[model samples]
Target: MSVGKSVRLFLSEGTPGGLITAEIMNWTGHVVAAPRSDLAKLTKRPEASRTGIYLLLGEDPDSVGGMVAYIGEGDDVSRRLYQHSRPEEQGGKDFWERAILLTSKDSNLTKAHARYLESRFIALATEAKRARLVNGTAPGQQPLPESDISDMEYFISQAQIVLPVLGVNIFRTTKPAKKSISPVTEVAAESGTESPIFEIVSKKHGIHAQAREIDGEFTVLEGSMVRKQWISTAAHTYEQLVPKLKQTGVVVDSDDGQTARFTQDYVFASPSAAAAVVHGRTANGRTEWRIPNGGINFGQWQTLGVENEPDTD
Candidate 1:
């Protein structure tokens, strides 16, 4: 009978007396009746036995791809199938629409067999849905492929629908600006000083240097300085100073002249020391000349009250 059909059913005359009635509902809510004789055949089967197996084929009859629910131990297979076929008992109209009942012939339905049938039916439904999506077939199109069906095979053996597409964006990098170090003269002029003793040495090559004084010493602050024709700077600064100096034709000649020795005693004092003795923090030597025994460093001497002797004859 077609799905969703309300039909009176009769059981076997021997066991479990009384006739059973069931209404078969399709996926679309159409109802039909099941035959009483067929119901009787189902009831005659031994209870709780795995003796017989039945397949609920799609309405198309020839359709291979369809759901397959199993009824193993129930007294009335027909009644159980009817339960699955109901709209309210199942999840919804879609569930009953897709459901197909299967029963084992042998009255020995095991838990494992029932589970297997349940899983297979679900998988088949899922695959059918996916296939419809792939073919661009809307809902309620046609019966799914079910030829060469095997009990051992999984229902969703093939791939389903494909995923959608996406998009992305990109960007670029930028560089920082250079800092300006004005000459001491420019700074002194800006401050309105009488005569700025400090001079700015703009060396494009040979130890590109910048210096600030320590306590009472002419310390090589950073990079290298060619003082008295010798490399004299602190060891740490010299390591950094040498490579930068090399870029400008300034070669670090050790006692051996092969390897460079950063044994200079420059920057022995910190900038704070100079700032304490000198008024402002902005002080650089190399330009600020000084006498041998000046009270403060060369950079500090410039701001001192005493006169400074020149290094040049």
Candidate 2:
């Protein structure tokens, strides 16, 4: 369902670590990226003078593992950069620490095209929710000929593909991290189950979860239910996490108001973190998770080795 892609990156400073420009194979779209300190130098390039869209990137002050971004389009992107480089008192933006400029190599993009691209990009970035949008108001879409609109949309598709290769991932949507497991292996010897699905359940609290190790991260799949109320002794980190997850729709409440369920796949850095969230208290995920009704804990399975464990029969 997916195809291979080729991306070419040019280091203007001729080293592996500095200002760089990227372009996808057979694509007219171009992207130039650099740290805030190199803004003046980067804007001096000829491509910066063309009509284009740009993104300003920085950390989100309110959240960890998240970023803040401001997207804009300009007739002369270089001039806009110059303006943003001014002092705060002169109306310069203060939140950005890096800049990425998007333009067409063949100089075919028009003012209307850039505006439409800006609006569409903002919508996409908002939908991705990977970054906090700093723009107070989104730029409205601009009118364009239907044929030109199709071309611009194609340009956007290519831009999305190339931006990530350039390390500009503000537009990326979140997905569970992945790891591989052999397809034909048995999961629980007692039940003779061949499926890899593992679980954590608390019948008293009406919690039942399905999880797996994915690319070194412990992932809880969507629709798995978790405890609605955390214990009073829950860790401070979990105290903060539970509400955040609920607010973000990662966990949703049931009509009975007695439980909350995961709405989407979520990956945790460690199994303990996942367990703590699921049970609403501090827990040792290694010992808490088990092959459903199989009596073997994850820690035992892991300690003895997953694929190599002898059949219990």
Assess each prediction's global lDDT (C-alpha) against the native. 0.28, 0.77
Model 2: pairs clashing at backbone N, Cα or C within 3 Å = 178-215, 179-215
| Candidate 2 per-residue C-alpha lDDT over 1-313 given as tens digits, one digit per residue, 9 for 90 to 100 | 1244578889998975578999866678899998898887888899899999989998874542257898999999999998988888998999898899999999999999999999999998877656778788998888899878867876776776678777676665434212211122312111011224579987888889988764344677789888886876635675666776776677889876878898876766577878888888888998888988776777776666436766899
Residues 28-66, candidate 1, lDDT per residue (tens digit)?
111111223354344344431232222232222111211
Candidate 1 lDDT at 57 equals 23
Name the TM-score of candidate 2: 0.72
Model 2 misplaced regions, further than 4 Å: 14-17, 174-202, 209-224, 229-240, 247-258, 262-276, 281-313
> Candidate 1 at residue 90, lDDT?
64
lDDT: worst 10-residue window of model 1: 161-170
In order of appearance, the predictions have TM-scores of: 0.21, 0.72
Off by over 4 Å in 1: 1-37, 45-79, 82-101, 105-108, 130-313
Q: What number of backbone clashes does candidate 2 have, counting pairs of residues 3 or more apart or in separate chains?
A: 2
For model 2, the run of ten residues with the poorest summed lDDT: 186-195
Which structure among the candidates has the greatest lDDT?
2
